[model samples]
Target: VESISVKKIETVEEFKDLKIQKSEKGRGISLTLPPDIAICEECLKDLRYKNKKKYYMYPFVACAVCGPRYTTVNALPYDRERSTMIEFPLCNEDKTSCVKEYKDFNNRRFHAQTFACAVCGPQYQLYDRSKNIIETNSIKEILEITARRINSGEIAAVKGMGGVHLICLAEDDKVLEELRNRKKERKYKPFAIMTPKLAILENLVIFSEKERELLTSFRRPIVILGKKKGSNDGILSNQVAPGLSSIGVMLPYAGIHYLLFDFIGQKSLIYTSGNVSNLPMGIRNEMIFEQLKGLADFFLLHNRTIFQRCDDSVLRVHNDKVKLIRRSRGYVPEYLPLPFEVEISGALATGPELNVTGAVLRRNRVFPTQHIGHIKSLETFNFLKNALFNIKNLLQIEDKEIEFIACDLHPSFYTTTYAKELAEKYGINYFPIQHHFAHVLGLM
Candidate 1:
């Protein structure tokens, strides 16, 4: 199939029957599921493209090739009906012109399932801490007001593709201190900042060419880079990274983020996950309000549901190579091939107790989950279980098909105990591997 090529046809009607067939079980691998992609350059231009009136300033504007994937998908086959975008149906123009664009092979959005626009897509609205909505004239105005509030020292819970982010002015020490006080667990921990563009980042951070690539990459992970000599000359507050010499900085990845910067005067904004302590970041609207009740002074929420909670991935360039600090959002659900083929058809690895990301091995490929944070509390532990369940369902991996369940050697760890429980429930073999040994095996 890889070597096969299609012969040229004189007319479009000649290839009417040509189609992509679905992969059957044991025949081939399932369709590769991509992680949530950052907004593309064309879509960014469409935000202000006067001629593309439908998508003008649309925060949820997306096409077939880009936007939410793993985070929005609710089932296999990866169709719009099987994604969170199902509720937000296409508008008249989207159904006609946009649909035609997808049919056009030359168009970038050819056969794109996530096609959307302002008239018929998920919309954002600003709300107060008391759950009351703040009326606005337009979507652009809403973001402008939100930015003004954030700049005026108000914390905002901004809903992203996967989860909500607690946003505040990056250069306000008093605001940063208040955010720390509210998010008790983040007292000493550093917060990541989001810059509006790349030119501003060049003057603030000392990063290599490779580091710059990571910062502006489509995955858009938060890259840790050293600060310039006078980087903190009123641009960034000392409290951003505390004692650390490096700071986590990322460029605006979404349309909302870009629109927010359009109204604000700050060079960067503190963009940290909106969650308490060891719990997972909030995804549902009600859950977010409850989770970040007092922490966020205002809420910049959206109607689109985040099927899965994926935190921003963190990475750093060391010795001209990239090292993943926290892998999520842009990097999960993709398979990693093992060096040697194993006879086992399927296997499960319940990850460690902290910064956990479970893995499922199917045939020769190992599929790791999005970052699941610390699995210490019941909430986080359940989140891990659900994450594993979701990936398993997507891959159509049955419990009986799993050859073994692997866990940390430490018996007291929740993952270890869960592995044992799953083994018993599924009547499968279970094994324990030292945490460091598992890491070494992965690297090899």
Candidate 2:
């Protein structure tokens, strides 16, 4: 591979002077990040070997193919310094003294990015609904307590990959009722349950071979699987599926989630966004208290501040094909190369209504933000606005330098409205692309 180095530019003037060129004599491969993968076979073997120094019990063991992505990232270039991993500095002492060849090898995370261990990585904490500290520095003890409380029919707000999820034993009627009453979510919108693995899900859902494969895929989206005939009614109350024929299900996406499901003693558990219905998922403890005060009996939280809010992505298998209903988390931040590289520098794309996804265009690609959910509430709108700013800042683009702003033609859309306002405020040209046509153009 050919290499070139340029002085780092920290100012807009200096940034303008920098040039990125493609070699005239070569063809190269461009790889978008594999959407947050499940533990690969190599890493799984390393984890399963009991005698190995990095054994299966190591909760933080991961390879380049798997682990946290958009959730832990605070900015772009996707380096550790630009991510939440910056909170935990590298253990120089351990690095110098370690004898493991892999530890020092030029692998994916060998000075690649976002490397951490249980020793220096993020930690867990617990709190009551009243914001009183319950415990700290003990994830196992806290999870055990939370599981006990849940079994006793109490709701617990558990923080996970992207945002908080209110976890409850799926089979408990009283707990479901209490959760519904507390959150005032009386609608029949089915809750997504996290199964420990695909084997556990087969008992609850009658999945075709194709459906099973999609469910077990690396993306691990909340797949709307066909519920088994005469499945346990108490597992998910009728309220969970007032009119829908299927329920959403997903596998554990993080190591903590895997442990949580194991501790809960069930092969599966109810996992839904920890927020009032129609609002954004809770990202911080303070926000959780403000939004889910009476909704949760206790909080199993962590010290790591979520830099972004990504809801669980939803998908459905139809006619032997997987269709994405909501795209977030495991499938974001990676840029999509445009057919033609436009001159519009740092353009913001206010996505269409319903399953909204914002985008930031730079160079020859567009980076779509995680699913922002239906933009009907103030909370969702504020999230869109903040996400736009965050995307621009992370990409190191100034508002004044944004050459264009893109929005959907739907005038009724709040996102479109916001895009218009931003265009006016920034004195940039606004391009209103028809929603349907844009999708067609994208496919072409």
Candidate 3:
């Protein structure tokens, strides 16, 4: 559906691999689900290479093949205006160079949706808990300052494409304990650690080819890796994962994370959601500071508005088969084909409470929203609605077809109530499918 044309060749020997018919043909509008791809080598080189012009210290630098997608996007055609990046317009050099490269098929940035440079893209600003600006002049210096704070055991809230993360040097046991206490997270819940690359983990954990692939893939989910046999694990504080032999580890998926790695050196960082326990991940910097109170010593944030809050996806390979733990980021806003084709078109399915998820059936595909936290609170419920529409608008399924609204049979549930209201308003049939029946059919 995405590709334009096909050509027949006389023979394999006659085929020239790199031939292009350059003409005055129209460029197609790019339609992408835009998962948060791991920053490509080119962008990483630009961050490290001083001669890369405006791309140096540009935390959000990206090309068409990589960078943020679902987190920054609002609605699509996948245009920049539909993304959080719409707020940052291109600078003169970046705009002119982008146009020149975009017109040339040979350029890597040709038709790149998220292409950006330092002068024309979002810049990271470090602020205190009161939101006072600490550093804004240069990313190199900003990261250096943030690194020093972390080394001194000060917690910093680093904002990413998805949401804000409360981060600190993971080597300090006191810092890990403080972060866990501040977040009020479960004692049994392990904190995921973020690092620069995969090479650092070679001595830390046992890695299979599949595990390495998942760790380095564009989705960039935290893969739970088992500890190496009889290997000492005193370097990273035990408070990170407590008694668990395995630890959740991830590589830098966004440009900002990679830049932070440069200054932070080889040390691990406690990267947990920037919100108190039982609440959604904080998006806006002001709201994050309010929620975190004085826990975050410095706020490393940018101007990008997260369309929807997405937690880092977590996966574990059990018996060499991938087991999804927390499904968000990288894997969302994409469709899952049902076992049997869903007959109804544009049907809404309101999932059950806790570990909650929602979906919309458009054509033969079911577009499930990313894990929308528990709908127990008003805030989480609002997040559910926002995520539902975010996926709907992106899928271009605005007019809800008058098919049945599927909800759990339980009465008085928030999700069920919302489904009833939507069904009534749309004059559609509502099915109160039993939660057990749903369990049998795997609908839940």
* Top candidate (TM-score): 1
lDDT of 3 by residue, 44-158 (tens): 8877777876777788888879887888877756677667777876554644465566555677877676777776677778788777888456677888898888889999888
Give TM-scores for every candidate, taking all chains together and pairing residue i with residue i.
0.93, 0.80, 0.90
Give one digit per residue, the lDDT tens place, for model 2 in 1-444.
135788975665533332323223221122223345565555556545656553334455565567766666665555567677678765545543222222544453443344455555566778887899985445567767877887787888888667899888787667776767776655445778888877777777888887777777776788897788666665555555546668898887676676676577754677888887678888987888888777888887777768788787898878887687787877765567888867666788888777788888886777777788778899888888787677666667777778778999999988889888889999988889998999898779
**lDDT, candidate 2, residue 44?**
56
TM-score of 1: 0.93
lDDT of 1 by residue, 1-444 (tens): 125777986765644443435434342344356888899988888887878888888887777657989999887777778888889766545444666665676677766777677777888988899889999999878977987788889899999889999999999999999999998878889999999888899888898888888888889999999988888889899989988889999988888888888888646999999999888988999999999998999999999989989999998987898888888988887777778877776788898898899988888888888899889899999999999888888888877888999999998999999999999998988999998998788777
- Candidate 2 vs candidate 3: the TM-score winner is 3
Task: Name the 10 consecutive residues with the lowest summed lDDT in model 3.
Answer: 22-31
Ranking by TM-score: 1, 3, 2
What CA root-mean-square deviation does each model show from the true structure? 2.7, 7.7, 4.0
lDDT computed for candidate 3: 0.78
Whose lDDT is greatest here?
1
Provide the overall lDDT of each model, using Cα atoms, as 2-decimal numbers: 0.85, 0.71, 0.78
Q: Is candidate 1 or candidate 2 better by TM-score?
A: 1
Model 2 earns a TM-score of 0.80
Instruction: After superposing candidate 2 on the true structure, give the runs of residues whose Cα lies further than 4 Å from its correct spot.
Output: 1-35, 39-63, 92-103, 106-109, 233-239, 335-346, 352-354, 362-366, 392-401, 410-413, 433-444
User: Which residue runs does candidate 3 get wrong by more than 4 Å?
Assistant: 1-5, 9-31, 94-96, 229-232, 400-402
Q: Deviation in angstroms for 234 in model 2?
A: 5.7
